[model samples]
Target: MWVFVAAVFALLYVPLFILAAFSLNDSIIVALPFRGFSFEWYSAALDDVDVREAVGNSLLVALAVVPLSVTVGTLAAFGLTRFRFRLKSAVAGLVGAPLVVSWLVMGVGALLLFSALSIPLSLKTIGAVHIMASFPLVTAIVSARLIRFDRSIEEAALDLGALPRTVLARIVLPQLIPSLVASALLVFAWSFNNFTLSFFTAGFETTFPIWVYSNVEHARALPIVNAVSTFVLGVQILLTFLVWYLLRLRPGGRSAAAPLLPGLATTERTDG
Candidate 1:
């Protein structure tokens, strides 16, 4: 089983490894025979003003999308988890519909919707589309955390004459911090790396991924593209590690999957 798992992981990561290795190859050609180790491609990628601008555009979109998506997603998760309403299940499903849909379909749908509304394709449109794409993932993570939340704690606070807002601010939000942070990081990374939505939505503006896609056809630019791709891969890996760490997989830390409220622990112990 372990061998099989290792093989699967290798299959997934081997391409990324090749991309990273080729990014450092001294040869301009990306063929098998690596001439020697060199940082020329990295320097060239860094020196390109267009690359820098694209990177900045991507960051701008991601920065805008992260807060909006996380805020909406967290609130939506709370609503789905705590409140009973007409068509609640339908609403929850709607919130997650993007996850089941193909990105290409979603991107085209968003483009058509915006076009009908007379909204021009631009960075703002890209950001909006990214928010929609990322919202489901963020909501899923936060809702999972909320499911493990101890409702009794909220009830106790209410019983002690706390207002709903007070209970949420003082009790709920604090417990949800880890999940919120993790969701934000994940959403930000996804938004930064997103290509399909950006491709349809970006008009004059080029994002990092779009820039790479546009230039990858140039054989001479392969090394520089590889370098940029490697950089993106590194950022993704770093964010993944941070999400794992923040979710308390570390030594001596409590699991994010466990109940977050102290009262719940006591209740469980007593019930057990």
Candidate 2:
């Protein structure tokens, strides 16, 4: 088992390690022994107007996706957890199935759907496509957190004279912070790294991944792609660490603690 796990980690991270190393390489073709280390590529990547536009487009897409995904996913989780509705399992599966589907298939389907609807493809259209693709994954993640939740707390909040909106906002939503934030981050990453869907839906407005792919054919722009990837990876790692630190600092510090509500259910060690 240990050997198998080690092999899996190696398979996953070896490529990442190679990319990090090549990002620092002075070679134009990202070949053998590093000729020398220089920030030249990084500088060039930063200065390129096209690279900046692509990065900005990625950020915009992620910004659009995160809120929509979170709102829809949270609502879906609430419905799944709070009410016994028909086709609940089927609904959840349909929402979450995109996580298991191939990106190519999803991309093509999205393109066809949008074309039929006459959405007039653009970066915003791609962002919308990303939201649909990502929402299911967010719903699945948030639903996992909701699964072990206790219903009595919500009832107690209602009994205590809290309005439905108040209970959701002050009681249920607070308890959902960790899971919600986690889902948001994952959705952001998905939107940011998206290639296939964006490629199809975004007919003209290029995103970072699409730009990177295009730049590969342009020999002069090769190193810039690596530089941009390095920068993005660094930013993502920093943000993830910050979120981890803040969650630990949020009045509980990893022990079993009170729920974010006075009358709500206690927060359980969710890992179990």
Candidate 3:
């Protein structure tokens, strides 16, 4: 098992290592036996106005998508997990359908939907599309957290004269904070990295991924693209470490910190 895991990790890291190495090369041409090592490409990436704008666009889209997606998804998770509803399983499958559907297909579908609504394709539209694409992941993460939660505490809150809204706000939402944070980070990452969805939804302007795609066809832009990729990888790594550190700060170490909603009766396993 350890060997298999090691092999899988190696497979993943090799390509990333190659990309990182190439980003440091002084030469503009990516293919080489060994170009002199320099941080010039990184500097070039910083100086390129197009790359900066693309990065900014990606950041803006993620900022818009993460909060909206997490809020909607968390609410949906609560409804699905806390109540017995008709067609629950079917609804869940529909929510998670994006994972199975090809991004290309979804992108095309999004373009059609936007066109029907008379919404002009643009960065804002791309952000909206990202919200739709990322919401399911938030729902799934929050729902997974909810499954192990007991419902009796919420019932007790009701018995104590708390209204349903009060119970949800005071009793349920607090416990789900970890999952909420995790979902936000995941959604942001997904939105930042997404290409095909952004491709269809983004009109004249480009996000980072779209910029990278355009650069792939141009010889001069290849090294700059690599530099942009390295920056993205760095940011992602930082966010990942931040999540890890926050989890570590929780009681009972990292594993115990998962998705326990605040004010929920975790020790007693109460109803959420």
Candidate 4:
């Protein structure tokens, strides 16, 4: 059993390790035992105008995607989890449909929708599609966290005369920080690395994934591609580490998931 697990992990990760290793190799062709280590490819990747522009565009779209997806997803999660509704089950199915649906189908559907609406494709369109693709994942994450939330704390806050929004802000949101941070990270990574949906919706705008795909067929670009991809992987790892450091284990050593509303969900009351 352990052997099978190890094999599965190796199948998933060994290629990534090799890719990272070759990105540092001082060889133009990505083969071989080893050339001396060099940062030449990394330098070249950073210096390329198209590569920089594509990366910049990807960052722009991902930045836009994170906030919007998180907001819409958090709201959707709250609605689904906190309310009694006629179509609650159906709504959940609709939200989760994107996760099960193939990117190709969604991409094609997005393209058709944009065309029917006569909306010209651009970076905004790309951002829109990314939000569409990513929010369900965000919703799923936040909903999972919310499901385990103790409602007594919330009811106490409300009974103490806290406004609904105040109960949400002070009583509910405080415990949801870790999940929100995780959802943001996932959304950013998803949008930045997206290709198929970006391809359908991007029109003339290029993102990092599109640039990498365009360059993939060229032998001359392989090492530089490796360098850029390695850099992206490092950034993702750093982001993950930073999030864990800041949220999972705080500087003061308290769990970020620890409830802030224990006895402090207080505000003055007014009778009307």
Candidate 5:
């Protein structure tokens, strides 16, 4: 089983490895045959004003999308998990509906919607769509964490006369820090790498992925494209590792401090 999984992963990533390797090759043509290692492509990509601008645009969109998605998604997850209301299940489904939709379809739909509203294709529209695409995943991640959370902790704090804000700030937020950070990192990576929405929405402005797509059409620029792609891939892998590390650290595990609510950890405690 492990061998089969490893083979599948190799099949998936081998092309990326080739691309990264060729990015460092001195040859302009991306064909095989050993070429001397060179960092000229990376230097060229870094020096290109267009590449720098695209990267800046992507960074701006990610910066806008991550915080908005994480904040709203976390609140929505808490509401859906802890409260009951009319059409609650329907609302949850709506929140997650984008996950099943094709990005192409979503992009086209967003384009038409914006056109109808007389909104121009720009960074704001791109960032909004990215947020919509990412928040569903955030909701799913945070919801899973909230589902397994011990609600008794909140109730105990409330019973002990702790204000709701204090309980949330001191206890709930601490427990949720892992999920929140993981979700934020995942959303940032998603926004940074997003192509379809950015492609459709970016009018005069370009993002890194869109810029790569445009430049890759020119065969001469393939090496520089590959170099930039390798850089983006490395950053994404780092973010993925951070997410994994955050999730792997068990929340509220074996800490020296006492429980948030006094006596709540005792065996005689009865609140569920």
Candidate 6:
């Protein structure tokens, strides 16, 4: 079991280790041969104006996508979980269809829709597509937690003269903070790394992934892309640790945090 787990982790992270190593390679060509180490590519990536612009565009879209997708998804989750309607199951299926569908197919379909409506493609279109693609996951995450909630507590609160909106804002949403935070992180990463969907929907606005795609054809740009990717990976690692530490500080502590940072969380069983 340990060997299998080790192999799986190696498969997941070895490429990242190699990418980080190559980012320091002195040669522009991204191939093996143990080139002398240098940090020039990192500086080059920072100095490149196109790379900077693409980074800004990707960051802006991702930041925008997190809130929009989570808001839409959380609302959908509430509708599905808290309300009864004739089309509830059908609506749930429709919301979740994107999870099973191919991103390429969705992107192409979105392109056709935008073109038919004569809506010019831009970062807005990319963000719209990302929201459509990712909101279902948020719904799933929040719905699962909502289903497990103690309905009696909410009922008791309602009996105490709490407004419906107040219960939602002060009770339901507080309990679901971990789910919301996890969903936001996932949405941000998905939006930032997405290429195929963004490629189809983007007009003149270039994302970081798009910039890398366009520049990868040239040998000189490979190391720079590697450097940027390594930097991104480092940031993600730091953010993950930060989130875990903050979760540990929450009132419920690591037990509450286990939902999002399972690897860093611990649980104990007691019998009385």
TM-score of each: 0.89, 0.83, 0.86, 0.87, 0.89, 0.88
Give the per-residue lDDT digits (tens) of candidate 5, residues 1-272: 99999999999999999989999999999998958999999999899898899999999999999999999899889989999999998998899788777788888899999999999889999999888877887788778778878999999999999999999999899988877887788778778888887888887889998898888789988988999999999998887766555554565443412231121112111110
Candidate 3 Cα outliers beyond 4 Å, as residue runs = 1-7, 257-272
**Candidate 3 C-alpha lDDT tens digits along 1-272:** 99999999999898888889899888888887657899888888899999999999999999999999998888888788878889998988888787667888889899999999999999888988777777877787778779877789989999999999999899888877877886787677778888888898898989998899888989989988888898899998897676566655655676565443331112111110
Better of 2 and 5 by lDDT: 5
Candidate 1: RMSD to truth = 7.2
Question: What lDDT does candidate 1 reach at residue 8?
Answer: 100
Task: List the candidate numbers ranked by TM-score, top first.
Answer: 5, 1, 6, 4, 3, 2
Better of 1 and 3 by lDDT: 1
lDDT score at residue 67, model 6, on the 0-100 scale? 97
- Model 5 misplaced regions, further than 4 Å: 1-3, 251-272
Return model 4's CA RMSD, one decimal: 8.8
Off by over 4 Å in 4: 242-247, 250-272
Clashes of each: 0, 0, 14, 0, 0, 0
Across 123-219, the per-residue lDDT of candidate 6 in tens digits comes to 9999999898888878877787788788898899999999989998898889888778867776777788888899999999899889988987887
lDDT of 3 at 227: 81
Q: Give the higher-TM-score candidate: 1 or 6.
A: 1
For model 2, the superposed segments whose C-alpha errors exceed 4 Å read: 1-11, 242-272
For model 6, the stretches where C-alpha displacement exceeds 4 angstroms are 241-272
lDDT of 2 by residue, 1-272 (tens): 99999999999888877777788888888778788888888988888999999999999989988999888878877787768878988986787676677778878898898889988898788877777777766666567667767779989989999899998788777877876776677678778877888888888888898888887887767777888888898887887675565455655575422332211112111110
